[model samples]
Target: MLSFIVLCAALWVSFHLIAGYVAQRLPLDWLADLPIIGASYGWERGGRCYEWLGIRVWKDHLPEAGGLLRDGFSKRQLASAEPDYLDRFAHETSRAEFGHWLTWALALTFFLWTPWQMGVFMVVYGGLINVPFILIQRYNRARLRRFIARSARRSARAD
Candidate 1:
């Protein structure tokens, strides 16, 4: 049981790391306005939908993995308003969301060695852990995109 547990942990970590690496290399434009990742009606509406989830109360309690890699971008704080920074931050949110989704799918590997009941448990566990992070990324990305658009319109008017 111990070895099986270790294997599960390793698989989860490996999947997330690979997903993060791939996300970093992906073009920002590719993630931008991706219909699949695009904000839904509630998320687009100032991310108010998240308030119902008590997101503000527990979001910070999750382990912060943004800084795990040496060159990884940390989303803990918004340090700058520069276009490039905001753009990259926006891209990072999509990246994080993609990573969670991929990791959740990869959890299926747990079933290969474990029994069916255990597999179901692993999958459920994966969802329980990843869903909140996924929602956070989506909520943040929606807000950030809205802010960027407003800024763009303001600049256009000034010009």
Candidate 2:
């Protein structure tokens, strides 16, 4: 009925608005990487029994001085690389990383539900809901990257 249609539309708008706000708050790169990191950390830490969410502890430590020393040789090589190449590489990597995280988030939602209900919800939301939003986020990210690149080019030209 009309009520059901209205309810669905409201939910759709709410999800996109919330997702956009949350996505903006975090670094686009980090947001893309977070889901994979969260899922991997969750799995490594005994599959959610140890921690329901991944904990991000902000601290600096030096555990690999030797690795740093080794990287010194490659520094010049990295310096010679094209900026656009690096940017494109990072964009692709972030996309893949975020895709994994999205999967994890969906899995967690399903896992928390009762057996039969979980399957039903997953089929409904995973296909119709989450997939569309994921595509939106991806499109947004591509637009953002293009904007950033254009701005940078303009600034460089001005300079």
Candidate 3:
């Protein structure tokens, strides 16, 4: 059973990596527009719940995690407010949104091979861990999109 769980995890990671790579190589921004991924139902909005959950605090504790796949902003420009930086970071979040869901699906599929109770545990545990990350990506994407829009307006005015 332990080995089965580990195999499930490994499968999840493998699928996630492949999906992420493909998402980067192809144009999949549209995938993020889907309701769950995009949080079209106001999930991305900042509110008391997020603060109470300490999402920001938790994220700060592992700042390195946010930059795992690709460095959103290089060290020297971590404080830079460049438009290009905002765009790159937004794209990264968008890709991550898709990757997380892909992982969720792969993890859930393990239910086919595991005992009913173990399957339920895997699904629940996967959600408990990934949902916050998904929400964070959505929240960050919302902010990044806003910033990118503002930057576009500023650039247009300058032109």
Candidate 4:
């Protein structure tokens, strides 16, 4: 029981820590809105579907776990209006989403260590822990993309 507790804590924290480091250095192209983890057909909605899940209400509560390595800005909110800054922020969203997905997958290691019943619980725990963050990342990324495009259009018009 004690070991399981320690294992879960270590796994969750370590994955994000390592992921934060990796995300900071990842090529922007790798973070582009592609498929699966990237921008999908419905993501253009800017997370409206997540409204029912109270994302706007509770999302602020989530820690900026990667902030230490992610340029020290709050991912929970917009950092800047600079096109370059917004562009980078959007990429961070993808990086964050990728990290949660990776953590969730590797969290399956919980299943291998515990009994079947406990393993099932761990799987559910993993999903519960990671899914919301995944949604938040996708939702934020979608909005960021739109914001970037709109700003660019507005700039073009002005110029």
Flag clash pairs in model 2. 35-101
Which portions of model 4 miss their true places by more than 4 Å? 70-74
**Alpha carbon deviation, residue 84, candidate 3 (Å):** 3.4
Give the Å shift of residue 25 in candidate 3.
3.6
- Candidate 2 steric clashes: 1
Q: Estimate each model's TM-score.
A: 0.85, 0.35, 0.70, 0.83
For model 3, the stretches where C-alpha displacement exceeds 4 angstroms are: 39-43, 46-49, 63-80, 150-159
Choose 1 or 4, whichever is better by TM-score.
1
Query: Taking the tens digit of each residue's C-alpha lDDT, what string does model 4 give over 21-129?
Result: 7666776568765467766556446667778888888888887776676354458667578988887787777888777777777667766776778767767877898
Q: On TM-score, who's better, 1 or 3?
A: 1
Instruction: Provide the lDDT at 110 for model 3.
Output: 61
lDDT of 2 by residue, 3-79 (tens): 95575456444544443334334454564456543223322333222223222121112121111321211111123
Clashing pairs in 4: none
**What are the per-residue Cα lDDT tens digits for candidate 1 across 67-120?**
777667888879999877987888888778877887888888877887899889
Order the candidates by lDDT, highest first: 1, 4, 3, 2
lDDT of each: 0.80, 0.40, 0.63, 0.75
TM match of model 4 to true structure: 0.83
Cα lDDT over the full model 3? 0.63
Number of the top-ranking candidate, with lDDT as the measure: 1
